[model samples]
Target: MDLLKFITAGSVDDGKSTLIGRLLYDTDSILDDQLEAIQRANRKNDDGTLDLAILTDGLKAEREQGITIDVAYKYFHTEKRKFIIADTPGHIQYTRNMVTGASNADLAIILIDARKGVVEQTRRHSFLVSLLAIPNILVCINKMDMVDYDKAVFDKIQADYERLTKNMNSTQVDYIPVSALKGDNIAMRSPNTPWYDGKPLLEFLETVEVNQQPEVQQARFPVQWVIRPQTAELPDYRGYAGRVVGGSFAVGDRIVALPSGVASTITRIELASESLTTAESGASVIIHLADDIDISRGDMLVKAGEQPVLSQSFESDICWMDTRPLDVNQTYLLQQHGKTTKVKIQDIVYRIDIETLERTASDGFGLNDIGRIQFKCADPLAFDRYAFNKANGGAILIDTRNNLTVAALMISEPVDH
Candidate 1:
């Protein structure tokens, strides 16, 4: 089964967690013991249903507050697909946590209460998921049970959402009216809304197409480590080890290693003990080159004619996670493609209004703030624009004193020289 990584986001009480729990429950992905434990807790929703939200509110603090604070990840597999679901907090204060969970997701399940229509959080999360460039969005209008599964409510909310997101970056948007708590239109279509017609959540998830696979795009092999089994027999063997992030690499293909820009041909590729002729993206393997040049971590291997942007300065879109606002004078460590280098902020272009997607002049960013900023690295780094290749274009900022990751960066176009 193919794997799909998605996230759930909405306002608190919008049923994000409940939607996840229902998807798991209806798919029979939950263990009997797990279900029994939830039942044993004796917590019941106001509608007299077993509190399925407890299935994902694993943290006691979360259960106590009836709110999710940290990103809760759940894994399950059905016959059609394997899934990684990130249930993120919906509170504005926990916005950083939501960004962290959404960073690597292929799709987002942005929830809305049928009774509440589109609230402020609906706008906030919509802007965020769009900023993150999450390819697909399943905007699940949840809590239809509370609204009596009214088609008018669903249609109005869906219309409002479409108008609001008309300018957002989300490429594909799908809507499903569901009652997550009551399992209505989740696994099977609910008959309560005779005027509505759409596939259940599970059915859509099982078949949604996401073309974010790296192997099928341009090839990128960022060097992570150098492997030299210094044993007696393998003294001459040297292999570059890393995960293939894009395209495919095959034996005898002409390749170039960047920063140094050395040209070489692949001698062999090995995944574990098995030797292979080609390695696709997402594969972790040791690549032996025909030429033993000075290859090291941070170097990128690409097809001879294919090269990523190599520069010391570039434009970056950042979602700051630090509580202490950004300091213009501070130097940070830019970690990208498994390599770290000293970096400093060159300029802050503008601050984006997460709620309205507005661009305005800004001094700096604070916690959960999003901005377009320029950065200068100590060394030239090879990268593609995040829109072109997500694997090579992503980076993080870390404080040198404490090594705390303070920002997530998505490299956009390079700054004009």
Candidate 2:
């Protein structure tokens, strides 16, 4: 079975955790002892039933406060497919946590409390789903039981959400009415929602196509290490080792080393002792080139004539993840794949108002603030526009003093200055 990675996000009390727990409970994905432990905790809902949210809100503080703070990851598999679910925090202060979880997800489940309808976190998380370029979105209109499973309520919320996301041309959106507490429309369709004709949440997830479009694919190999052993037994053995982060690499294919701009053809591809003719995305292999070139760590290899934008400055959208405010005067480190270069914040164009989705003038960004900015790298970097190819376009900014990652960046386009 293929794997699907997804994230759940919404406002606090939107039932994100409960929905995940219900899926695990109804699907029998939870262990007997684990089920018994939550039961033993005796955390019950308003109606005196066991609180399923506790299954993911495992932190004592979270259970006591009834809110998720950190990102909680859960894994389970059914006969049809395997899943990795990230239950991210919903509070405004924890928006950075949501960004971290959604970074690698193929799908995003933005839960809307049927009782409350569309709200701030709805827009915030939706904006993030678009900004991160998540391919698929399944908006789970949860707590349908609270609204008596009325079809009107589902339709109203669905319409409002559609209007909010109509501009998201690249993302595919779908909706389902669900009462997570009652195990309806999650693992299976509920009789309560008889008017709904769509497949249940689990079934939809199993069948959804999250594969990347092959037409946009391009090869990107960031050389993490260059191996050279001048032993008498095997002289002049040189190989570049790294994981192929995008597209594929085949032997005899013409390639170029970026930043160096040297061209060569792939002589061989090896995985440990085995030789391979080709290596696809996500494969870690040592590659040999036809000609010895001055390649080093932090250099990238790409297919000839399909080179990424080479520039020392670029525009980007960033989420400030640190407590300290962004300072344009101070120098930071921009780490893109294997390359780490000194970068300075050239300017902060604007800060996004999460609730209204407006770009407002801002002096600086604080924790969890999302905005548009420009970066000046010390050396020319090879990167694609984030919307075009995420594998080679995403990067992170690290604080020079503490070496802590301070921001998540999505490259927009290369800039001249």
Candidate 3:
């Protein structure tokens, strides 16, 4: 079974957790001990109801506050596929946490309360998901039970959301109506809303095609470590080890080490208990070179014909994470993959208005603000556009003094020459 990773996002009290808990419970994914524990807790509660939300609200503070403060991950499986769900917080204050959770997700399931109908938080998260370039989006209009499962209500919400998404860059969008509490149209077809004849949420998830092509326009492999075994068993063994950020590498392929620009041919590819001829994106393997080259941690290996832009200056879209305002001329450490370097903000072009989708001319950015900015690194860095390659295009800025992550960046454009 293939593994599928997805994220859940919506406004507070939209039953995001309940939907997930229902999906797991109804599918028989929960263990017997877990069900028994939940039953005991349900009996002790004053409401005397199951409170299925308790299955995911495992934290003491979460139960007391009745809101998810952090990203909660849940794992379950069906006969057809394996699932990894990231239950991200919906409150505005936890926007940074949401970004962290959705960074690696293949799809995003955005929920909206049928009665509420496209609230501010919904727009905020939708914009973020688009900015992150998440390929697939499933907009689930939840809590249909409260609205009498009205078809008109679902259509209105869908129309409003469609108008909003028209300006965004998301490639795929799907709409579904569900009542998470009663398990209507979640794991099974709902008789309550016979007007809707689409596949259930579980079926949609199992059948969604998530195969993505490797970003091969620019080959990149940031060296994590230099593997060396100097014992008598196999002396003079030197290998460059790292995960492929973009493209593939095969034995005997010509490669160029960046910053030094030394040429070499791939002599071997090594993995645990196996030797492979080729390696693709997301695979960690040690590569042996035909020539003795000076390469170390923080250096990158790329195909000689497809070299990435190496620049000291670049522009990026940044999601500010720190409470303190961003300042021009201030220095921070930019970390990408295994490479880290000191960088300074050259300027802030503009801040994006999530609701209006407009760029407001702003000199500074506050927490949770998304803006376009220019950066100057201490040295030239290899990179590709975020749309082309997520691993090579993403970066994090850290405050030097406090060592706190202040910004999450996506490379928008690279400076030529």
TM-score-best of 1 and 2: 2
Q: Provide C-alpha RMSD values for all models, in order.
A: 2.4, 2.4, 2.5
Q: Per-residue CA lDDT of candidate 3, range 99-150, in tens?
A: 8888888899999999999987888888889888888889999999899999
Tell me, by lDDT, which candidate is best: 2
TM-score of structure candidate 1: 0.93
- Angstrom error of the Cα, residue 312, model 3: value is 1.2
Candidate 1 lDDT = 0.86
Please give each candidate's TM-score. Answer: 0.93, 0.94, 0.93
How many backbone overlaps does candidate 3 show? 0
lDDT ranking, best first:
2, 3, 1
- lDDT, each prediction: 0.86, 0.89, 0.86
Would you give me the overall lDDT of model 3? 0.86
